[model samples]
Structures are given as C-alpha cells and as structure tokens.
Target: MNSEFSYRLLPGLLPYYAFRVCTKFLQSQDLILPGVIIGFLANGFNIFSNWLFIFQFELGVNGAPWATSLTRAIQFIFMILYLLWRKDSLADTWPSFSLRKLSYNVVKPFLTLAFSGMFSFAAEAWSFEVTTILAGLLGTIALDSHTITLNIATFIYLSFPFAVGIATSIKVGQLIGEGKAADARRSAIVAYGVNFAVQITLIAIVWPCSRLIASLFSKDEEIVDLVASLIPLSCIFMLGDAVQANTGGALRGLGRQKLVLLLNILGFWLLAVPFGAVLAFATNIGVRGLWWGFTVGLYSAAFIGILFLVFRVNWEKEAFKAQRRIAQTSQ
Candidate 1:
C-alpha cells in the first residue's frame, strides 16, 4: 500500500532511477540515458540466457534454477570482462589479495553477507521444512496441499528481492562514489515507494485469479482448493517479504550487512521459527499456523531492517571514509 515502492520493484531499474535523479542534480541527461541503456542490456543478458536455457531444455520448475545459476555465472564473467575493457568507468575497482586490507575491508563484509544470506535463506527454509514435516504428520493430503501452496508462493517471493538487489546495488554504489548523503537517503525512500506501488499493483492483478496461479504448480483438485484458500495469506506474506528483502539490500549497500545478518538470525531463529512451532504443533491453526509463523518472522525481520537503516546513517559515512582512506593509503 506504500507509494514509491522502488526497492520492491527491480534492482536494475533502481540504477536508472538513481541516474535520473543524479543527472538532474548535475543537469546532465546525455550520458544518463546511454548508461541506463547499457545497464538494461547488462541485466537483460542474464534474463535472456535464463530464458534460453529454460525454453531450450524444457527445464520446467527445476530447470529454472540451474539455468539461472548458469546465466548468473555468465553474467559475472561478462561484467568482469566489460569492466576490464572499460577501465575508466570502474575507477580502481579491482582489489589486491592482501591480508591486512582484506581483514579490514572485505573479510568482515563477506562473513556478514554469508551469515545474513544464510539467515535470509533460513527464514524460508525453516518454514518450508516445518511445513513438510508437519504435513507429513497431518497426512499425505495435507502435505501435498502445503507443497502446492508453497511452490506457488516461492515463485512469487522471487520478484521483490530481485528488485531490491538492483536498487541497493545501484543507488548505494552511486551514492558512495559521489558522496551524496542526502540522495542516498532519497534512494532508499524511492526504493521503498516504487516497491510498494509495484507489489500492490501485482497483488491486485494476482488476487482475483489466485486459483489460476495455484494451478500452475499442481493439478490436484484438493491441493488446488487449499492453494486457493491460502492465496490471501501468500499475498500478505509478500508484503513483509518486500520490506525485509529490499531493506536488507539497502543495508547491504550502506555496508551494514553484519547487522542485517544478526537481525535475520534473531528474527528467524530465535523468534519466528519458535513461534511457528508453537502455533502449528501446539495450536488448532493447522498448516495455516505454520504460514503465520513465517509471516511473523518476515515482518519482524523487515521491521529490524528498517530500524537498522535508520541508525546506520553515520556508519554509512564512516564506511565510505574508511574505504577512501584505504584507497589513498594504497596509492
């Protein structure tokens, strides 16, 4: 329901939006459009490759993941090559494998990302695992229904985070490079706004035809019924999902990934999963109780991500300064 939901929209688009705002600030549009075009192609390359793998291989559900991973590797290689060739665009982008510098700059960030990503992965993985286990306890029918609804929900979950990744990578990278604190704040705002608008629009479009969406994953009538019943909750889950994913990405851009990881750990491990266990196993809410636990966890992480960002302003400045000092010292 929030407006200007940029973060939940598309990560690729955020760079373009940031460029537009940044160019306006500098009164230059000539390079902005071209840069955005290149960025679009850059993003589209992997997407196109993914489609080719899927369509060509008939990879269906599982094929998509492999295709995506392969395409991402290709994309990474392409970006590396492009950056190498276009050295001017990447001002000192490469890093030396020095222990001292690595310890100070890259190691903590990498570990933070590892933990944060694991926690993020855990949020859903824990719920899905719980659902499967509980479903087994309930009977094959309940398990099938749970699986059907979850697969559909999983597809839906992919959209918001992709958008968030792009927004954070672009906006944060630009702000750090140009030292635009005010615009960095605006970038976060714009991301949240665009994300809200896009997601709400998506929900409206998807809500009326929830059954149709559910049917894509399975053909079982009873499962379809369960899926239909759960569509509203799935939509609700995505709202919190939007907040957690994009906000996490924003924090990453601001170099507070460690805090995000910690929040994720506490939100999912200590709070959401435990609450879900109590609700699903100990209460009468049935499988729906499990989902409620997932929802609670997502909302909790989202709230923590926002709070983390709010308190991270000075930290962002300091991170940039530290990076600059390192770069200067290296020179």
Candidate 2:
C-alpha cells in the first residue's frame, strides 16, 4: 500500500509528466543522445539513493521503496529544472495562464493516451504475474526455475530491444507530429528489422551459453538443468516478444492506444492465460506447457501487430490525429 501510494503520487507532478512527453518529443526531433544521458543519470540517482538509504541509513528492505519514491521526486525536480533551463524547445507547448485551457485541450488527450497505454501495459504485466502464480503451483523446483529463467529473460529484454522499442515509439510519433507519415512508416520498418536482428543474435548467444548462465544463478544441478532447458524455449519466445513489443510501440506512436489495449487484453488474458492454464493442468507437459502457451500467445500478438502495421494502418490519418491532439492541447 505504501508503495502503491508513492506510485500514485507521481502523476501529481504535472511538470514531470509534461517533461517526459517533451523528452520523447525531443528524441523524435533527433536530440536523442542528451535524453539518453539524462536517463542514465536518473537511473544512477535511483541506484545511489537506494544504496544510501539501504546501507548508510541501515533501512534494510524498507529502504528500497523509499529510495524509489525519493528518486522519482528528484527526477521530477530535475526534469522541471531542465525544462526551465531549455525553455526554447518547450515554451510553445508549455501551458500558461488558466488551468482550464491546459486541462481541456492538453490534459484530455493525455489522459486518453495514458489510460489506454496504462491498461495495455498492465495487461501484459498481469499476465506474467499470473504465470508466476501458476508456476508456484507446480512445485518448489518448478517455481524456482521459473523465477530464475524469468529474471534472466527480463534482464536481457531490458538490455536490448526494449530500448529500441522506446526509441522507435518516439521517432515514429515525432515524425507523425511533423506530418512525415512516410518517414514514420519507414522508421517502424527499420525498428522491426533491428529488433529481429538483435533478438536473433541474442538468441544464438543465449542458446550456447544457457547452462553456463543458469549455473551462475544457482549451484544446484537440478535447478540449473531445469533453467537450461527453459532458456531455449525463452529464446524462441523472444522472437515473438521482440516483434510484439516494437509493434506495440509503433501503435502507441500512431495514437492507436485503444487498439493496442484491446489487443493486449485479447492476446494475454483471453488467449495466453487460458491456454497456459489448460496446458499446465490438463496435459502431461507440466511447466513447459505453460511456457508453450505463453509462446503461442506472444506469437499471436506479434502476428496481429505486424498485420495491423503493414496492412491496416493509415499513416496520414494518424499523423493528422497527432497534429490535432497536440494543437488542441498546446497554448
């Protein structure tokens, strides 16, 4: 509850939220290196604060959440200061005078985007959490294997295509905002190509090093063996995962927030969870079945996302929508 409250309090920092979008906008404008530096600094502050509170103050586990809250607060302050310092880039977009003007135009579209985007991400996260719970039901060894494999997979994901997705999202959105629909489409295509190449390369590395990687996490032969087997499956999963993630990013860029939200729900909750549950319980495959179900769902989402991007999207219309949204919101 305390953690939840701290997270809830983040939206209260209006300027921070604005600056986050502004930073993404800036990235789209080809000013990405600075944003990356700032992001690194922010992450460093988060880690440093955690260390300070946990060790220096001897707060133990409680220190971690407090550190998170503190880091976000500091980030909010830093972003606001940065915006003020670089007023030229943000001055036109920044709201002034009546709060009503900002609320109706800017805040409305933002809320629309935020709510849908939040739901879309939440659906994916919740599906994974549900899978974890199901893994626990399998037995201690199964759950441990699942935990270790998931942690490693998540780490690899954060290290690679995840960043590409974010960068692509910003690039595509910015291009749309500027009415460069063709460029936005081209950016999405390039993002997909890059995601596939990187994921495939990582898959090769992971496949050969699976046992070694698993051993680093655990000394137990049984646990390590279980994790090693799962790694190959996870590599396969990454193919679909990379595609879905980047495609989702592209959809977000196109302001198809509601569509993305619907797709996530259909893919994860409607398809993945049920299929995984069935495979886990009704079949002899046990934990592996669960992962297979997850793979199927991911591929399902990836296929749908790719199809939408290639066949259904109207780039010009999306660009117009982005323009209207920003125009209506800005002072």
Residue pairs with clashing backbones, model 2: none
Which segments of model 2 are wrong by more than 4 Å? 1-30, 97-108, 324-331
Per-model TM-score, in order, reads 0.69, 0.86
How well does candidate 2 match the true structure in TM-score terms? 0.86
Span of ten consecutive residues with least summed lDDT in model 2? 7-16
Global Cα RMSD, each model: 9.3, 3.4
Residue 329 miss distance in model 2 (angstroms): 4.9
Q: Residue by residue across 100-143, what tens digits does model 1's lDDT show?
A: 76654545555765676667656646656856787678667667
* Candidate 2 C-alpha lDDT tens digits along 22-101: 67656656777656667678789989988998899997776776776666666667766776787787666564687576
Quote the lDDT for 37 in model 2: 69
Instruction: Sum up the clashes in candidate 1.
Output: 17
